[model samples]
Target: MSRNTESPVDVDEALTHIDSRGAKIRKEQLERTLSQLQADSELTADQRLAVERLSERLVDRLLAVPRASLQDAAQNADEETIETAMSLFE
Candidate 1:
């Protein structure tokens, strides 16, 4: 069976594409969460500044996660979220 270059049957390519899609989705979700935090009415100036800084840090950290295992990346992201939530009280 001859392989078609126009139609990829490469397993690695398919996995790479899937992982790329998942990372895109996670990035969008993070953006939405940050937007919600920024739009909240009750936050004081310092709280808002803290959230904005944290949001930027999250974006940086998220971009650094390996693309091959997005589920694990997301789990680690959830840990960051938990840490951020806790930081609000401290």
Candidate 2:
């Protein structure tokens, strides 16, 4: 019997692995990344403040809608909403 030895994976670099983990897992990854960025020692005071503001905005947006409704909107975005989004890019 032959044993196969493979190198350990860097989970963050594996796109397919990340995608397979679904929304909750991806949310966790986003939080971990944000925390890591916030803790970086080299950021200037202004840069840190900007990151803090962005983080607050992210929290606000996430809490603006209930999870079920957000999921529903994502799965069934109405034509009017789609058109409005398209117009923004035009």
Which candidate number maximizes TM-score? 1
lDDT of each: 0.49, 0.45
What's the lDDT for candidate 2?
0.45
Cα lDDT of model 1 overall? Answer: 0.49
RMSD of each: 13.6, 15.8
lDDT of 2 at 7: 40
| TM-score list, all predictions | 0.37, 0.31
lDDT of 1 by residue, 1-90 (tens): 233355423333333555465556656776686678768755677875676577557655654443334444344543333333323323
**Weakest 10 consecutive residues of candidate 2 by summed lDDT:** 9-18
Worst ten in a row by lDDT for model 1: 81-90
Error of 2 at 73 (Å): 18
On residues 1-90, what C-alpha lDDT tens digit does candidate 2 reach at each position?
A: 123264432322232232333344445755686678768756677875676566556654653343333334445633333333333323
- Return the lDDT, model 2, position 12: 28
